[model samples]
Target: MTTHANKKTALVTGANKGIGKAIAAGLARDGFTVFLGARDSEKGHAAAAELKAEGDVRFVLLDVTDSASVQSAREAIESETDRLDVLVNNAGIASAPGSRFKEPAEEIAASMRIVYETNVFAVVAVTNAFMPLLLRSDAGRIVNVTSKRGSIGEEGAWVGRPNMTYSSSKTALNAITAHYARSLSATNIKVNGAAPGHVATDFNGFRGTRTPDKGAEVAIRLAQLGKDGPTGVVFEDDQQLAW
Candidate 1:
């Protein structure tokens, strides 16, 4: 097994494409040995290969919804490093592609399980599985990549197509983030949420005005937060987003 005890390391889930890819690239550039956690082996490898120019980037198979996959990912990561400095739970769906706001009410209801499974449930499983490694770090950081629509406190949240499942899932994720921060308050680990404003990615059918790189800025920033930085808060860029 390889040892990365002297080097900082990070893992970004759903990193084969979109904002997750950008986050992996940014972390790699920032000198962290980045692990691109993706379900698709081919795409994951391809993404890691492309990000090679940035710095040390590798691919790990991670289907967050599956308990076995999560366990395998943890083992794979543990094989390389004794500690995980950063964890970016970026794998999420704002409704399946092309079906956005078009699915029947019953269908949308059925899809809620899948949505929560990915955006909310998976975050808990993956974080818990990796928490041991994170605890070993001198300063571990967790960045939950949520969405602005999750902000029930914002007026815009109700203005959109009213994707109840997706929006509510994010809200649930935000609560989980806060609970994690509260639980780990006395530890060296810092937990926070990042609402990367909508960006032009396949998730939104490319309707966003921002680029993937632009969307990734907040998450990458949160992942590298200083020891004195605030925890249990969600930020979009430098501004805090409502819960």
Candidate 2:
């Protein structure tokens, strides 16, 4: 295993493409030894290779929906470094855009479960597995990539929208972020949620108005926060957002 005693190390899940990829690249460019976590080994390696010019980047296979995979990823990182300075839980899934909401209760429940497996439950599993390593860092940072639609305060805007699974999963993620931030308040760790507004990505059928790089700015900034940075907050661009 190779070690970088002088540089901070970061792990970003779902980093093979889209906003996660942009976050990995941004961290690597900032002199972090970034671990690009992807479920697909081929894509993970490809992304790491693509970012080699930026800094020390490597691929780590991580399937957030699987407990075994999450544990294995934690072990893999532990083998390389004793501490993880940053963790970006960016893996998430959404039901097909513009698809009709299932009329049957069973179908809706299944859809919600599928999305939650990746967005909500996986975040909890992955964070718990890496908590020890994060605590070892001098300035640990956890950034949960969330969405503005998760805001219950904004329900009026999406009252009739067909995004139950995706939006509610984000709401759960925001809550999870708050829970961790408060739990770890006495420590050096900072846990926060980031809303990447309307990014054009495969997840949304490439229909959003912003680019992935622009969407990743807030997450990258939060990841690099100092010891004095705020914890348990949701941020979009540079502004604090409502829970």
For every candidate structure, what is the RMSD over all alpha carbons to the true structure, in angstroms? 1.8, 2.2
TM-score of 1: 0.95
RMSD of candidate 1 to true structure, Å: 1.8
Q: Worst ten-residue run, lDDT, model 1?
A: 96-105
TM-score winner:
1
The C-alpha stretches of model 1 lying farther than 4 A from their native spots are 1-3, 96-108
| Clash pairs, model 1 backbone | none
**Against the true structure, whose lDDT is highest?**
2
Query: TM-score for each prediction?
Result: 0.95, 0.94
Candidate 2 lDDT by residue in tens digits, 106-200: 35566677788899999999999999999999999999999998887754235556466777788888889999999999999999999999999
Model 2 lDDT, full chain set: 0.90
Of candidate 2, the 10-residue stretch with the lowest lDDT total is 97-106
lDDT of 2 at 68: 93
